[model samples]
Target: MNIEDIKQRITGFSNELYPFAHALIPEELQAQQLVIDGISFLFADKDCKTRLFDLLEVTEHEFVNKEFFDLKKVSIKVIYALAKKRFTQLESGLDINQFGVFYRLGLSARAALFLKYKFGFDADEVSEILSLSRIEVMTLTHESRSHMVDFIRPVQEGLQQ
Candidate 1:
């Protein structure tokens, strides 16, 4: 493959990965660093795609096991996961925290919604990235909506009473 082709691929991947990494890690510098590392790794390996996938698998397992939750570590993990996948389309939405709806949700629920709604990833993609089952991703999405309802219900009740 042409070196230019590889550079283009890395750029596209960074766009797809950056928002999710920033959102999940809540540290912009750390998130950016991870993406940089991913790009560097991509350039260094001939079989970059496979290498990225292997890194993602390791990251996913660590996330699921709750073994690496530090912002920098999680940022690196998420970047590797994002690099491994290819997103065919690009979409945009406000950040999850910016929407003021996800603050009280659990991390899993927030990540599920962010990947699904914000990034337009399907159940399978989100499942792979987060190392959750499709069912788990679905459940997380549903629970996030439920949590939003719960958060708003009291205001509705107050207004009615």
Candidate 2:
């Protein structure tokens, strides 16, 4: 495809990928770079969603189980089963954004939440996008919501004070 065709094909996809990359990667420039890398793969990867998965696998991540805790322990209990690394999201520092919860989740969970919540994708679509079973997508979303409740409670209570 020509440059214009490629650009037209990937138009709205970069917008989605950048935020997802930003959620996984803290640095704005780094996130943009990653999305650009993903976009560059448009010629190779047939689908935008597939490119997203490729980006997810390649990004370096800190894998810590329950590593972030301040005054109270806000553990993503389900993560223990998955041995997923803990993360400190943009608002996980209690920065007060309602959607910050997505930043704390594992890759699958975060992607699932983003696709489902941000794109209005249903479980079936998310399962296809993330390459997970329907049940797995459901479970990941459940865990994401649970993690939100688990962490947000402490921040909310503190904020109310």
lDDT per model vs. reference: 0.58, 0.53
Stretches off by above 4 angstroms in model 2 are 1-12, 45-101, 154-161
Q: Which is the leading candidate under TM-score?
A: 1
Whole-model alpha-carbon lDDT for candidate 1: 0.58
| Model 2, span 8-109: residue lDDT tens | 535545665666666655556756766665555444545533533344334233321111111001111122112223333333443324446555566677
After TM-score superposition, the amount by which residue 93's alpha carbon in candidate 2 deviates from its true location, in angstroms, is 17
lDDT of predicted model 2: 0.53
Model 1 clashing residue pairs (backbone)? none
Candidate 1 lDDT by residue in tens digits, 16-110: 66776555544566557657775565546566445444444463554523421222233434564653332111112224456466645655666
What lDDT score is found at residue 108 in candidate 1?
Answer: 61
Q: Clashing residue pairs in candidate 2, if any? A: 64-85
